[model samples]
Target: MKGSYSLLDIDSSTGDVYLAKGASIGICLGAVKVPRVNPDTRNVTYAGTMSGCSNCFSSDGTGTLYNLSATAVSTKIRPTSVLGSLDVATGEPRDSVAVRRGPSAGMVVDGKNRFAVAAFTAPEGTSYIGSGTAFVPDNNATGQMVIIDLTTGDVVRTMSGFRVGGHGGSLVHGGLMNSVQLDPSTRTGWTYGPYHEQIHQFSY
Candidate 1:
């Protein structure tokens, strides 16, 4: 069960196992047991972190939360490269990128079997690299949509610079985002974070 500090995954049928450490890490992993035990709870019970997060299932029938933050490349912070799957069971990932920054907060899997990551961004770099602030001026500004292709385990596209400067008196902060969904039937992706108020649509 993914919670404020721990990640747990349990296979309802076979009882396989997986786990991530820390409260923030666990939250990002999500919790499978919560839904089964508490019907009133929402799917996003667990939140993630900026450095250690991912979505995984545990052997105990629980969900997982994880982070996909940017990795250091030479001297600059690049989003294209990051550590492999934080899940020990999955070992290291092959084609994966930190689709989000400042703690990927939340993510949803589409019926098409692809993952659409929500994160902050600026300058439209190679990946999700934003200050995580909802809205900021100049260097701390945040805006962008990070898309991850689950099938290929790699970032397919990025919608960055959707907004500039805090609009409508809203200040940007590195916190939970409220834009990210997928339409299974149509294979469309949507992302609307605080920085970019506009709802973004995309096709795989």
Candidate 2:
């Protein structure tokens, strides 16, 4: 509770709450296992953490936690971006793969863990340094949606030329691209931005 908390996701199967903590590394950056049983009290136990993980999703069947690393803070710059997988029970990293887009925002993993979709906020004329806290997006910046294969970690498809902007919080917290949801049964997904009219839909 001490660190700055941003994005949040829940594993419906286990009732675990996954939280993204800004400026925190290691175990403190992931989920807090069912910290509360009733309304007044909280437990707040650590689930796990991955370097630069700003957004996370948990698979219902396997309980594997998938996170997106959008920036490289140690190198003092934003890199291409990466997606990492972790075993929720043991709190260990299972797999990691590079993402094709840079400065990504929201992400969602399919129910079967077959694929993941991410929303990207293209930083057209801005320069990002040290986790993108100073990034400033220009008018030329456009939105992109990418589908990544979970098994091979490959970008299967990309959709671009949409309205996108990184204007909410600091880029390190995923800017304005902070909302993504997927319906595994229909293979449909939705992404949202700060503007109410900017909601987008996709199908796989």
lDDT of 1 by residue, 1-204 (tens): 444423344334433333343223122222122222223342232222224433222221223223333322222222232323322233333334544433333344442454545444353333323322223346754566556665565677765644423221122222332244556677676655344657657654
Q: Tell me how many residue pairs clash in candidate 2.
A: 1
* Number of the top lDDT candidate: 2
Q: Which pairs, if any, clash in model 2?
A: 35-43
Across residues 1-204, which tens digit of lDDT does each residue of candidate 2 receive?
555555555666666666654323222233333121212245576666655455444344456767776554353544556787767688777778888535566677785748888777663334555443335446555677788888888889887755554435444435533466788888887776446477677786
* Candidate 2 ranges with C-alpha deviation above 4 Å: 23-41, 52-61, 73-76, 123-141, 193-195
Cα lDDT of model 1 overall? 0.38
**Shift in Å, residue 70, candidate 1:** 5.9
Candidate 2 lDDT: 0.59
How big is the positional error of residue 168 in model 1, measured in Å on the Cα after superposition? 16
